[model samples]
Each structure stands twice: as C-alpha cells, then as structure tokens.
Target: MRERAVSGHPDRPGRTPGVTLPSVTERKGTTNESGVRAERQGTAGRLPALAHESPATAFGDYRAAFHSARLPMALLDGDGLIIAANPAFGELLGTDPGRLTSAAAADLADLGSDPRLWTAYREVLCGRSDRLRCTRRLKHPAGQTLWVEVGVEPLPGGERFLLTVADSSDRHDLLARVRHLQMHDPVTRLPNRALFFERLSSALEAASFEPSGTGRIGLCYLDLDGFKAVNDTLGHRVGDRLLSAVAQRLSRCAERTGGRGGDASRGHLVARLGGDEFALLVENSAGTDQVAELAQCALDALQQPFDLAGQRLSVSASIGVVERTAAGTTATGLMQAADTTLYWAKEDGKARWTLFDPERNAHRMTRQALSSTLRPAVDRGEFTLEYQPLVGLGNGRAEGVEALVRWRHPQFGTLAPNRFIALAEENGSIVELGRWVLEAACRQARAWQLERPAARPLFVSVNVAVRQVWDSDLVADVAGILAATELPPELLQLELTESAVMGSAGRPLQALQALSDMGVRIAIDDFGTGYSNLAYLSRLPVSVLKLDGTFVSGFRSQEHPNPADETIVEALVSLAHRLGLTVTAECVESAEQAARLRRIGCDTGQGWLYARPLPPERITALLDADGRTDDF
Candidate 1:
C-alpha cells in the first residue's frame, strides 16, 4: 500500500516537513540489527515504525492506542510537567483529559508526597534511573480514595518520561479484609493474641524512636474467675456469649478511661488473649495512676451480672497492672510482670487488681533460684550441723544437744533451715537432706561419746521431716547410720514436729515403731503447738515431749507471772511422767524461766539460757569445762 507523506509542526524542531514512516508489518519483518538491539535495550529503546506511513498517521495511531488503553498513561517533559495525558489517566483522577495537560505530574498523583518517592521520581526524569515504581494513595476529585501503583520510565528520548498508573484498590481492599480476619478473635470480635503482640511491639518501637511523648507504657492483664465453671455448667455457646458481653464491657471501660487527659486518640487496646483472659494495652501511658484507673474501670465493668443466652451468671476477674518507662521495657518482660501480678491478685483474693511490686518479685525470684539449686547444693556438701545445748533443768547440766542444720550457700551466705526446709519438702529433696542430717548428727554423737570415755555422753537429737518417713526407708536409714557411725542407738534422739507425728499410720507408723524398738529415742518437738492429741501420744512409742516455746514464753515474766502456764505445765509433766515419757522445756531464756521449769518437774530444757548453738569444737570445749568442774 502507498502511504501519504505527512508534514510536521513548524514550531517543533528536529523534524522534516515531509517524511514517510514505515508500516508496522514492514518494521516487524525488517532484518535491521539496530532495531532488534534497540528493542532488547528496554523502554528507552527506539520506536519501531511502518515503512510507508506518514509521521502524522503514525502519531495518530499511537494517540489512538494510548487513549483507548485501560492502563492510565501520561507523558511528562524533562521538567516533570505533564505534556499530555490519556483519557484513561484523566478518568482515574476524575478529571478531563484536556485539563490535565501542563499540570505537574508529581502533584496530580501525589508522587512527591514522600521524600524518598519524590527523589526517585526526579532521578527517573533526569535519566539517572531507568524506572521508578511505587504505590500511592491518591484522593480523587470525585471524593473517593484510590490506591494505585505508579510507574515512571525514561522515554525513547532522554528529554521525556512515560508515567503509567494501575488501580490497586481492589487488591488492597481484599488484603485488608484477610488481615482483619486473621488478627481478630471470632467469638469476642476483639483483637487476638497475635494482633495484640504486634501492636505492643510496634508501640514500643515507636516510643524508642520518638522521645517526645511520655515514653511510658502500661498493661492490664486479666483472667475471668470461675469462667471455667460456667463453661462446664452451661454449654460452650453460652460461655462464648458471656465472653462477648465481657468484651463489650471492657471496651466501654477502655473508652471511658481513654478520654482522661485528652488521650482518647491513644486509647487502650482491648484484646482477647484466648479463653477467658484479656489484655488492655496503653501506649504512651501518663503514669501508673492512669493504668490503675483503667484496671479499676475494667473491674467495675465486669462486676455486673451478664445475661447470656437466658442464663443469669455472676463472675469476678483478677487483674495484674504494670506500668513503666518504655526505655528499658520489652514486650516479653512486661508480659511476665503482668502475669506474675495477676497471680498475685489471685493469691491476694479474686475480684481485685494488684500492681507489680519489685521487692516482692525479687524475693520470689530469689526463692526460685534457691529451689532450683537445692539438690545440687546437697551434693556439694554445703550443709553443716550446729549443736544447741540441751540441759537437764534439775541437775543444771548439759545432758544432750539438739542438732540444727544450716546451709553455707556460696551466693546467699549462711541460710537458716526455715528458709529452705519447706522448699526441700515441696520439691521432694527433703528425703535426701534429712538423711544427711541423720548421718552427720549420728557421727557427731559417736565422736562426743568416744571423746568422753568416763563422763556421760551427750545424745544428739536430729529433726526429721514427715516426707522422709513416707518417701524413704527411714527405719533402715536410721539403723544403717547408727551402725556406720558406731553410735549407740540409745544415744541418738529423733525429733519430729507435733503436727508431723500426729495421725501417724501406714508407713510413718511402722517406721516410728521399728526405730523405737531398735532402741533409738523418739521425741515430739513443739508438743502443744499442733493437734496436741494427748490421747494419741500413748499409742505411739514417744519417749519425750519438748514443750512448745509458747508455753515456756509465759515464764519470761517474773514480776507478773502466768500461773495458768505453770499449772498447765505441771499437769502435762505429771501425765507424761506416768506414761514413762520425760518432758523438756524449750526456749528457757532466763534463770527465772529455768527455775520455774525445774520446779514444775521438767526433766530437761533447751534454750539460749544454756548456750546458743555452737560448732563441734565449742561443744567439745563445753564438755571439757563441765567435766573438770560442777559449775555447769
């Protein structure tokens, strides 16, 4: 086909007045290496043309294609001013195609809104970058927001650039819906655990970067008390309704408390953390007072009865409140503190809120550290025995000694038995510890007996935990320790707390009987403090009763004496004597207390009045001093 030659505009330079362009089919079949190479070079490649087409006809075809294309397209000059915009581009902005010409391309699509995007856009227009692509949110002239992806590419000539936009609102909306479902709890319609943590982390990060705010964060972690009972009694469907109602109340509480100090914009985030637990996060918290107010509001909200699925139910909640400066706080650390505080609230009694206490938490952490290291401490031989003199009140002489166990901890220094004895029992380490005490005390008693061949040997009394009787072979252990130490069974006294020895049966009963039959003396320490079952004492092989300190504390007063204490002691002594059991008074701090105890027919006394607990060498010195003179 013969094509007409077209004339170019007289105003535009670098164009021939009459030029003929090639046909599209002829350009495609041309074996020109430069054309193929240009096509491979990318968007900046030279434009292919028809062999016999005029410049006007080619330009008209190009304009037709550009206007009819679905993608929004625009042509920008070197100055970033839109020289031409296709119909599709004008429709995207809800404007006329003619009106868009000569406008700044950056201003039309908000390309220069962000500094980074603006820099890249300038780079592409200046031929420094091949292309620039970014997603932008634009406000259309029609009062609608459009999310579009804008692409800027260098034109075939270095002096111009081609800008195209693709509408991404549908894809963005779909993604938003999917994210909303994933981040929310279906039942309560609140943010779930994943979303809560994400927001908390983001808030913390923002606080770190922006130091202008309060720089403090707060959280209220709460659990619904007796919610499990509700789920068990009623169906899970009813329980879910109750949870939704609780969520609504909590949301209202957060809303009410958020308006304080004009912080409604940074309101608390109420989230359901699975099951009956929920969390309220406060970013840029003013102080602990704000957090506390939120917690109290939540408590008050949940206190009202919830009518769920025709079931009227009442439930209380326990909350842990934690507020601290965000500078040193982490999501994990904050959550842990909140969890511990919640436990404290439960322990302090439900239906209340407790703030995080550092001192109490430190003590608990120390206790945990001690518990974890206890069994190993025993193997390391960190325990030692100290002996307190047990004197015969009638003779005024040290008849025996009560063996007290102390832990020479490496980190915590010397710790008394009360600090770790109960911990040992709870972790089942008491059996091992009790065995060590038994063996050590027995060996010491034998050493004392061997040291003093002529004088009366001091019997060693060792404390026994009730767990040892049930958890270990107490009878066999006692016999083995005596045989190993070569200590006479008669010289070893085993002391058990009154409560531990009461209601003895099963293994404990059998162990006590076998030990007594083996000639080991059995003594009940802290006699009157426990069951005080004077009747059951006869059935057991109890050889001695150490009066509790409370009964003996009455003897501390001289000017105003407690006659009732003395009378009670006298009666108990008379009854014990008839049962062939000797009575020992504990905590006899003064001579008057000792004299009164002696006058009441008490056979022995153990207290600071005689001597505080001493090491082995000190006990040996006391024995030597007593042996040389009768002044003891």
Candidate 2:
C-alpha cells in the first residue's frame, strides 16, 4: 500500500482537478486573517515540494498529520486495542502517547463498562456503520469527569478504526452557568419567579394526572411589613443588605420545616418573587397544618433584628398560606389566592399568618368590586342621598336632617354609606363623592325651604370624610355648592368625624374656620367614638356635637342604665352647651331613649325613633304636614 503525499484531499491520490487547498505552510495561521491561532492546529510537520512523489514521504506526511491534529485522534485494531494515539489524546487523558497506544480507548475513558458505548463500538468495528459520534464521559485518575464528544470512523479495510475526541467541558460549564442565572436571583441567590412558576406548574400538572387526594401543594406568600418605609428612610444600599439577610433567614426556615417524608418533588422551595415579596412553595403538603407551621417558622425567623451596616433594624412579615390538592388547582390561581390572603394578614395586623378563607375573600372581592365601581357610579348617577330627620327633643319638631349617601349598586341592591365609604376614601374617590353629596344635600334643602314658605328652613347636615377635608378644596367646594343651590349657609351643616376635627389644627383647621366664617356650621359627627380629645375640642370653631350611637344605647335600660355611658353623654352635652355648641344624640331608637336624651339636655336627636333616613320626596311630604312641626 502506497502512502502518497496528499496535499489536498486526504482520500484522493492527487490534488483535486482545478480546485486548490491551502498548502500546509499557508494554512498554518487561523482560518480568518486574524493573527489568532485557528481552532484546529495545522499538521505539525510538512513535507517539502521535492518529496511529493515518494511513498516514504507520503507516510511521513500522514504520520505528522495524525500527531498534529489538535483534536485528540487515535487508531484502533479489530481487537479494540489502541494501536496509535496523538499527543492531544495523551494530553486529554493525562498520559503519554506510548502508554495510550497499548491502552484500549475504553480503558482510558472507562467506556467499556457502559453497555451502550460498547454496543456502538462493536457495531462500527463489524462494518455495520461507517462512523458514529456521541458524547461520553472521561474518567480521570483525580476523581474528575471530563465531557468529550467522541467520533469513530471505520477504516477502509474494516480491520482498523480512527477515533477523534473533542473536549466539551468548557461548553457544558458555560451552559450550566447560564441555566443557573435563569433560575436564580442574583442578589440573594434564591430561586426566582420564573423557576418557581415552572416548578409549581409541573407539580400541578403531575397532580392533575394522579388519583384524588394524592398530590397537594401549599404556598406561603410573604411580604416584609413596613419595608418600603425602611427603604425610603435608610437608603437602598441598606435596604438591599437587609433584604439579603432576610433571604438567609427565610432559606433556613425552608430547610427546617421541610422534614424528610415526601417524594423527590416534595420539598420546600423558597423563592423571591421580587422586591420585598418572597414565597415558599411546598410540595406534598400534609395539609393546612403543615403550611401554618411553616408560616409561623418564617415569622419567627424574621423577628430578630437585621444587622445591616452596623444598624440593627427590626422587621416583621405578613404571610398568606394556601393549601389544596393540585388536581384542580393552578399556579396562577394559587399565587392569586396567596396574595389576597397576604393582604388579610396585613389588615389583621402584621407579624402573623392568615390562611385563605373563601367567605372572607368573597366579601372582600365584593368590597373591591364596589370600590372599583364608585367613580363610574358617581358619573353614572348611581348614587342617591336619603335624609334622616334630626328632631328637637324638647318640642318633637324636625330641627335638621342628616344627609346619608347610599349606593344604588345594580347587582347588590341599595347599600349604606358604611359599605363602601372607607374604600372610596382609601382610593381617593371620596373627594369627588363628597362634593356630589354636598351639592345634592344643599339642593334638596333649598327645594324643601322653597316648598314651605311658612316653616323654618331645616338645616341639612352632610357627612364629610377626613380625606375629603384634606385632599379636596372643601371651603371652595362648599361656597360654590351653596351659591349654586341658593341654600343659605346657616341651613347647611358639614359634619366631620370626631377624629377628623381633633386632628385639624393646621391647614385643615384653617379650612374649617374659613367655612365657619362663611356661616356654614361645622359639626363634629360621631363624637366620643374616637380620641375624644376634650382639651382641644373647645379650641375649634365647631358649632354642633353629634354624640355617637354608642352613648345612646345606654339609655335603653332606664331602670338600671349604664351610668358611665350616661355620665359621659351628660358631660359631652354640658361641655358643648358651655361652648355655645348645639348637641345632637344619634340612634335614639326608643321613645325612652329620646326622653332620656331630652332630660340630659340634648337639643336634637336622630335615629329610627324620629324616622329612618327617607328619600327627598318623603321628606318633602313631611315638610308639607302642618307647617313641618307635626312631621316627626
């Protein structure tokens, strides 16, 4: 067999007709014009042009190419012996070329023990395949595994085979790093939302296929209470450090609570869902009991002060726990429920955990629906006001009417002000709603006044939320509504809660005084229900005090009335009278209650005893009865 000096194609006797391959010397540099070495190192030794036709020269070229191919190369005989091996293969195996030659390829890489690799090798050696390529692990004496792409090409005679190996360790390492980043949070090195969702979805899917009551999932969604305030006050650097410390504690919680009893997938997975919110996904949950215990563990873990930049900062967490069989549940549904329950924990007070309650959640959803509908309802005229008469206790005459706002919710029938007012205030819709109520009350009052020329004009009192006073142009709104409705200032009373008036010493105080100067009376509604700050009560320009209904409830048992409540009411009445302020008692449901209020010197009473809050037409009808004195 002649080994020709093949300068072009390795399989051909001479250079390809007309096509030229770069000579060994020319191709020594990289594939690109860059000075960097080519990924494949060119054959080490090159034959001179004068020796191109000799058989021995061809053998030298072939031998040089075999040793110089940068990718590890080897040749094997029919018996699976390593007949020849390149320096690269020796370097890859950490052995000398001479040692590699006598050593079987399988022995060098421990591939013979793997049945799959041995089968593929036997198939190639028996001429059943021309070539085979696959990834295999190389066992090093240092107890390390090296990944390599191994390719076997059968020789023309089938008695010999050539093997080429390319180390894939670096590529595999790069891929592993990429995968880690994708699943983990960089700051805390915790599983991120993406990875958490993937796990949750997989668990749920597996649960769906299993029998009922087999697989269950639990999730504890946690939010750091007062974390935003800390971030704003302490700067983001400290906040970040605090978050890292919190993450460490939460991870410890996961490890401690996830006892060894469940399947491979059944474990605690604590992940950061972003910001100060983190979640723990529990697989094969034993029930709410286990979930609750885990949540408590997390709460206890976070109770310790975080040491950040030498500052020990106290922190608390609110956790929402949801546990259910994975059969019909979903990742999105679980997360949503957990979030809602977390809000319940916050509302119930921080540093605790709350389990999901369907009934409570339904009520909250209804409230949220109402809050969202408020602004549109206002614009759509879905709100109406009913007036409850404030009757004079001495003469049984209608003294004033408290204007109460009601929502004519299309789905839920008519709702009282208490149902949605707080939500409105929270979402800043109260300002507009307040303005609307003021104008409606004033218009109704003016209409009643005009209808009864012989009767005294009844003053209309409209409840003003604290937010309305602070966030809205209350003074200007009152003035404009008064002028628009032609209602006299004295006939319009603005009722603020006791807390609202007690805290009004700055701009709010100035606004109240300005309204009072305009002759629109300012009254403290629901008095004695709040802080009941008597010291500052006399300093305000308030003209009326509507005692909260809690005070009037004591008057029910006249035989043995609650003396403390009676005394409190009496003192409130005396104080208001001393300040020249009118006193009105709320919730005088019984005649005896009204009479007791009268005896206590309460100038006015408002409750079911006088009348439930009536629509404007009903009140107008009452105003026409006997010059309005017999209406009550």
- Top lDDT hit: 1
Model 1 spans > 4 angstroms off: 1-65, 75-83, 101-104, 115-133, 152-162, 259-265, 627-632
> All candidates' TM-scores?
0.85, 0.69
Highest-TM-score candidate:
1
Please list all clashing residue pairs in model 2, or write none if there are none. none
Model 1, 54: alpha-carbon shift in Å? 12
Q: Write down the lDDT of every candidate, Cα atoms only.
A: 0.82, 0.79
Q: How displaced is residue 603 in candidate 1, in Å? A: 2.4
- Which run of 10 residues does model 2 get worst, by summed lDDT? 12-21
TM-score of 1: 0.85
Q: For candidate 2, write residues 307-346 as lDDT tens digits.
A: 7888889999999999987877978889899999999999
Residue 501 shift from truth in candidate 1, angstroms:
1.6
